[model samples]
Target chain A: MRADGVLGMLDRWGRSALPGATLLFFVLLTLAPLRAPYLSGALPLLPALVVFQFSLATPERLPGPLLLIMGILLDLLLGGPGAPVGVSALGFVLIRAAVVNNRRYLVGVPFLFQWFGFCLLALGFVALVWFFTALWTWTAIDPLPALMQYAVVIVIYPLLAPLLARVRARDPLNVPDASRGTARPGETTS
Target chain B: MAIRDDFEVVASQVRTAVQRFALGLLVIAAFGAMLLGKADTVLVEHARVLALDLASPVLEAIARPVAAANRVIADLKEFASLREENARLREENVRLLAWQTAARRLENENERMRGLANFREGPEASFITARIVGDSVSAYVRGALLNVGRKAGVASGQAVVTGEGLAGRIAEVGENRARVLFVTDVNSRLPVVIERTRERAILAGDNSPQLRLTLLQSVAGVQRGDRIVTSGHGGSFPVGIPVGEVVETGEGSVRVRPFADFSRLEFVRVVDYGVTGLVGSGGPAAPAAPPAGVRVR
Candidate 1:
C-alpha cells in the first residue's frame, strides 16, 4: 500500500478503535481506588464515551440497531442491575442522529449545553438501572446517592470535556468541513 | 443484462437483512446474560472472586496510602486537644474503675444465677483481631473485607465486633481474607432482644446506618432509650453483647443505632464461637486454649 493508504488505514482504525479503548479506560477508572465501591462513576456513563467517539469520528458508522447492541455489551461489562448503558447509548444515538444535520444547533450551542445533556443522560441512565435492579432484586435502593454522584460528574465535565477534546479530534463544531459545515453561532466560516 | 441488474439490487438488500438479524441476536444474548447473572451460581461467584482477586492488588495499593494519610491527619487532629483529652481520660479512668468493681460483682451474681438455673455450660468463645483492608464496592450493601481469613483462624459465621459492641458477621471467607457483612448491610438479620425490656425482635439492616427492629411481639415495654443486645438464638453471634440503642421512629417502627463507628473502622475482633464443643461434644474448640493475659472469668 502507498504511504497515504497506510496512514489512511491507520486513521480509520484509530477512529474506530479509540472510543472502545477509552471506555475501557473509564472502566479502569471506576475500578480505581476511591471512597465508593465499584467504579460506579465510570460505569454508568461508559456508553457515552462510546457514543461520543462514534459521533465525532464516524457519525453514521454504527447503525441504530448496532448502537443498541453496543449498549447491551456495556451493560453486562458494567455489571449493574439492568440495561442502563444500553438504553443510554440508544438515547445518545438518537440525539446524535437528530442533531447531526442541524449545523446551527451543533455549532451555535455552548459546551454547557453538551455538559447539561451529559448530565441529563447520566441521571436518566442511573435511574433506569436503579429501577430495574430494584425490581429484580426485590429491594429498593434510594436514588438520592446516585443523584449526588451525577452532580459530581456535572461539576467535573468542564475539566473532562477539554481533556477529551485534546485527546480526540477538535470539536466537530469548530471545523465546518470536519462536521460537514455544521458550525453553529459565534464560529468563523474558516 | 436485465436479470443480472435485478439480482445485484436484491443481493445488497438480503445482506442487510442478514446483518440486522445477527445484530438482534447479539442484543438478546447480552441482555440475557444480565438477567441470568442474578442467579449468582457457582460460575458467577467464581467470576466475582476472580475479578476481586485480580482487582484487589490495585485497590490495596491505592487504599494503603489513603488510609495511612488519614491516620496521620487523625493523629494531628488529636494532638491539638491532647491535654484536654488526657485530663478527661484520667477522670474517666477513676470512674471506670468504680464501674468495673460493680460489673465484677454483677458477673459473680450472674454466675450464681446460671448455676442456680442449672445451665450446663457457659458460652465458649475465642477471638482474633484483624484490620479492615477494604470496603464493599456496591452502594446497596454495607460491608468490609478483613485481612485475616481461614488461614488465620478466621471462619465464616464468626462475629466481628469492636470492644464497644457488635459490628457484623463474617459472610464469606477466603484463604487469607474474609468479607464481613456489616450489621447495617441490607441482608443482615440477627436475633436480638432489647436489653432493658427483654422484648425479642429481629435486628435487620436495610442499607442504613440504623438497623431496624422487626417482628416485635410488643412495643409496649420497648422504649426509645432501651438498649439492644444479641439474643444468640440464631447460634451465630454470642449472647449479651451490646448491639445498639433503640431509636423509635414514627408509626410503631424502631431501629437500632449500631455501637461501632463504621466510617473510621480500623480494628475489629473476630469472635470464634467454639459452638462445636459447647453445643455438641463438650470440648475446647480450636486455638487449643485461650491466650494468656485474657481471662474468661
Candidate 2:
C-alpha cells in the first residue's frame, strides 16, 4: 500500500515536474538574500524573468498565489513594512494578466519581440516599485537604483531565456516518452 | 461523446474562473499585509525575524564559500599593495599616538570628575564580531546580513561598528544570522552631536551616500570640516561613537559623510552597551524592553 502511494505521488510529480522545479528554483532565488552587482544596486529580477516566461506560455503551471508568496518572501527578506511585497505581488498579478491575455500574440513570436514585450512588463515592475517607495518615504529617494535594476534585468533575461526554455521543454517531452503506450481507458491520451 | 465534451468544457471554464478568483484573493491579501504592516511595525518586525531565521541558515551555508573566495580576492589585492598599506598605517599610527596621549589625559580627568559627582556605574558593553555574508536584495530599505545570529546573542538595536568607525545597528536577528541596518538606510535615525561646536542634531539616513543631519539647534555655526558623533540621547547607541563628519552644511541644511565605508563592509562588531539609563534595565545583553505601548516603529 505504501509503495502504491509513493508511486502515485511520483506519478503526480512527474506530470508537472519541470514547471514546478523551475518555479521553486526561482522563488528560492528571490527569497535568498543573494546580491551581486554588475554594478552597485543593479540586482537582476531573476524571479520576475522566470514568472514572465512561464506565465505566458504556461500560465496554468505557475500559479498566481505562488507568485504572491514569492513576493511575501521577498518582502520579508527585503526588510520593509511589507510595501515591497504588496507592490511586487501586484506587479506579478498584472504581468500574469497581461501575458495571459496576450499569449496568442506572444507565444510563438521571435525572441526580439518577446524581449520587447518583457521590457514593457519590466517597466511596470519598476514603476510599481518607485511608486510604493515614494509613498513610503514621502520623497522619491533616487531613480538611479530602480533604473539600474531595469537595465540589469534587460541584460540578464536573454542569457536566462535559453535555460528557461530547456526546463520548459523537458517535462512535456518526457510525458510522451515515459507514458508511451500507457493509455487510460477513458482519457484520450496525449 | 458530445455530452462528455460539453461537460469537460464547462469543467475547464470553472477551473479557470476559480483560479482567477483565487488570484484576486491573493492580491488582496498581499495588500492587506502591506497596509497592516505599515500601520503596526511590531508585526512586520516579527515577520522579518521569522523569515531571516528560516532563510539565514541556508544563506549562511551558501555564503561561506563565497565569503571565503571574497576574502581570498581581498587578501590578494591587499598583498599587492602591502608596502603602500604598511607605510600608510605606520604614518597614521604616529599621528594617532599624539591623539592617544591627549585622550588618556582627558579620560583620567573625566574619571575624576565622575568620581566627584558620585555617578552610578553603567553596565560595561561587550562586543561580538561577525562577518557580513552578503548585501541585502531589497532596494526599499538598505540592509546587510551577518553570519552570527541569536545563537551568538546578537539582538536588535545593538550597535554594529567596524574598526574604521560606526557602521550601523542590528535591526533584525535570526537564530544564526542577523541583518544590520546601515547608517545610510532611510529608516536609520541617530541622535548625533557635532564634535567641534558641541551642537546637537539628528543624523538621518535618506538612502544616500551622505546622511542628512536634521533637527539642528543651529546650522549657522556648522562647517564642512566639523566632526560628528552620537549624542547618546537615545538608549540604543552609547555615547560618543565616531559616526561621520559634516561634508556639506547649507542654509538650514547639513549633510554628513560617514567615517565607515559602508559599501565595502566585510565584518563588524555588535556592541552591547547600556543606553537606556540602566534604570530597570534587565541583564547585560538583552536590551531593555519597549515600554507598554511605545516600541520604536
> Highest DockQ, which number?
2
Residues A1-190 of candidate 1 have per-residue lDDT tens digits of 1236777678666755665556544543443223332233343454454455345334544555555545544333333222223444444445445444443444436777656656655566567666765766677776666666566666666766666656555323335445555655334432
Candidate 1 lDDT (Cα, whole model)? 0.63
DockQ per candidate, 2 decimals: 0.15, 0.39
What candidate 2 gets wrong by more than 4 Å, as runs, is A1-40, A81-85, A136-139, A173-190, B1-16, B72-94, B97-122, B149-151, B275-277, B281-297
What are the per-residue Cα lDDT tens digits for candidate 2 across B1-297? 999999999998998798778867877887886687678877778887887777765666666665566567667878999999999999999999999999999999999999999998646776777777657744556778887776666678889888877888888777667888888888888988888888888988877778999998777889898889988786767788999988887888788999998656766888878553355456443443223322121
**Per-model TM-score on C-alpha atoms:** 0.69, 0.81
- In model 2, residue pairs whose N, Cα or C atoms come closer than 3 Å (at least 3 residues apart or on different chains), thus clashing, are none
CA lDDT, candidate 2, residue B236: 69
Candidate 2 chain B least-lDDT 10 residues: B288-297
Please, what are the lDDT tens digits per residue for candidate 2 over residues A127-185? 88788767865776677767777888888878888677665554432222234346442
Candidate 1 local Cα displacement, residue B134, angstroms = 2.2
Chain B TM-score of all predictions, in order?
Answer: 0.78, 0.79
Residue pairs in clash, model 1: A30-A39, A37-B137, A38-B137, A107-A184, A108-A184, A108-A185, A176-A181
Two-chain DockQ for model 1: 0.15
